[model samples]
Target chain A: MALTFKPLADRVVIEPVAAETKTASGIYIPDSAKEKPQQGKVIAVGKGTKEHDMTVAEGDMVLYGKFSGTELKLDGKDYLIMRETEILGIL
Target chain B: MALTFKPLADRVVIEPVAAETKTASGIYIPDSAKEKPQQGKVIAVGKGTKEHDMTVAEGDMVLYGKFSGTELKLDGKDYLIMRETEILGIL
Candidate 1:
C-alpha cells in the first residue's frame, strides 16, 4: 500500500532496514545479539519548520541514533516517525 | 562567579533546581527514590536559528524532560545545555 501519511513540522517517516544477521566472516549472528538497526529509507517528510529546512528526501537512505524516533505502524508495516534533526546523516 | 558561556543556535544553558528531599507531607524521602529534577532556571539563551525564534529568556523557570539535554559543568557549578525545543513549558 502507498503511504499517504504526511508528517508535521520537521518530522519524517522512515522504513527501517532489518538488522544484520550475519558476520563479515560468514558467522551467523543470533537474534539475541542483533543490535537495533540504525539505517532506514525515508518515506515521507514534513515541511521545514520555521528555522530549519528538510534535509532528507523521500527514498533517501539515512542513518540515525540507535534510540531515536517513535515507533509507528502504518498499513500493517512498521515505521519510525522522528524529526529531521534525529537523522544523523544521509547515506 | 557569573556565567559567561553563550549557547549556540537554539540552545539554552540552565541551572537545575535541586530535587525534592521531602514529600509534600514533609516525610523524608530516600536518595534512591528521588526523581531527577525536571525544572530549571534559564541562564543563557541562543540567538535562535534561521527558521525559529527563541521562546525562552534568561531567568525563566522552565520545565523539561527528565532525560533531555547534555550535562555540563562551568565554573564549578553544574548546568544543562539543550535546545529550546526540549523545554516543555515555562512556569
Candidate 2:
C-alpha cells in the first residue's frame, strides 16, 4: 500500500519496526520491561525548513527518540509523523 | 546590564517573569504547589528559519510552555533559551 499522507515543514513519516522481544544474547524479554522501539524506516519526508535541508531519504533506517513522533494509522498500517530533528541518526 | 548573548536559528532568549506566590483571592501558595512560570519577556530573538519569519520582538511579553527551553544563566541572571515555536503567544 502507498502512503497518501504528506508531511509539512521538516516533518517526516516513518514506519516503525516491530519492537524486539529477544535480547542480543538470546534472552527473551518480557513485555513489561520491553522498551519502546526507537528505530524505523523513513517513508516520507517534507521539504525542509528554510534554514535546514532534508538529510534523510525514503527507505533509510533511522534511529530516533523512544517517545518521539505522533502515532498515525493509514491503510491499515501504523506510522509515525515527527520532525527530522527528532531522528537521532541514519543507520 | 546589557545582554551579550545571541541565540542562533529561530531561538529566543527569555527572562522569565516571577511566578505569583499569592492567589488572586489573596491565598498564599505553598512552594510545593506553585507551578513553574510560563510567562516571560523576550530579550533576544534569532533570525528566523527559512520556512518561518520571526514574529516576536525584544522586550515583548510572551507565554511559553512550562517545560520548554533550556535554562541559562548570564551575568548573574537566569534565563531560558528556546525556539520561537515554544512560545505559545505574546501577551
Candidate 3:
C-alpha cells in the first residue's frame, strides 16, 4: 500500500516501529510503562528547499527524538510527519 | 552573558520569545489560556556531523515546534536544547 499524501519542503513520512514489550532480563513491560518509540522506517520524502538539501530517502530506518513529529493515522496505521531534521540518524 | 554550555552534534540552544498576553484586537489573554511560543533566538549551535552541515548560527531568531526540545534552567534563565532539525525556520 502506498500513501496518497505527499509531503512538502523538508518534511518526511515515517512508519514508527513498535515499542518493545519485554526487557532483556525477561520482564514484561506494561503499555503504560513503555517508552515512546523513536525508531521508524521512512515512507516518503519531500522535495528539499533550495538552501537545505534532503538527506533522507524512502525506506531508510531512522532514529528521532522522543517528542518529535506530528502523529497521524493513515490507512489504519500510525505514522509521523516530521522534518528531515527531526531524524537523528539513518540506521 | 555568554553560555558556557556548548551543545553537541546537531543540537542547538534557544532562548524562547515570551507569549503575548494580548491579541491584535487588544483582547487580553490569561496565562492559563495562552498557547506555547514557537519562536526563539538561537543562542548556540552544535558542530555539524559529517553527513549534516550546520545551518543555524548564534543570535538568529528561529521558529520551532511548540512541543520541541528539552527545557532547562541555565544561569537562572530558561532555555531549550533541541536538535538543529527542530528549528523550523530562521528569521
Which rank order by lDDT, best down to worst?
1, 2, 3
Q: What local lDDT does model 3 show for residue A86?
A: 80
Angstrom error of the Cα, residue A53, model 2: value is 9.0
Instruction: DockQ each candidate and list the results.
Output: 0.04, 0.04, 0.03
Model 1: chain B TM-score relative to the native chain B: 0.80
Residue A39 in model 3: shift from native, Å?
Answer: 31
Give every prediction's interface RMSD: 14.6, 15.3, 11.7
In order of appearance, the predictions have TM-scores of: 0.44, 0.44, 0.46
TM-score of chain B of each: 0.80, 0.80, 0.79
What is the interface RMSD, in angstroms, for predicted model 3? 11.7
Which model scores highest in TM-score? 3
Poorly placed runs, candidate 3 (over 4 Å): A1-91, B21-37
Error of 1 at B78 (Å): 32
RMSD of each: 11.7, 11.9, 11.8
Query: What are the per-residue Cα lDDT tens digits for candidate 1 across B1-91?
Result: 4455556557788998755534344433234544433777898887776767999999987778788886554444667778899898887
DockQ of 3: 0.03
Local error of candidate 2 at A60, Å?
Answer: 35
lDDT tens digits, residue span A1-91, model 3:
6655455558888987655533334433234644444767898787776667899989887778778887644444667778888888876
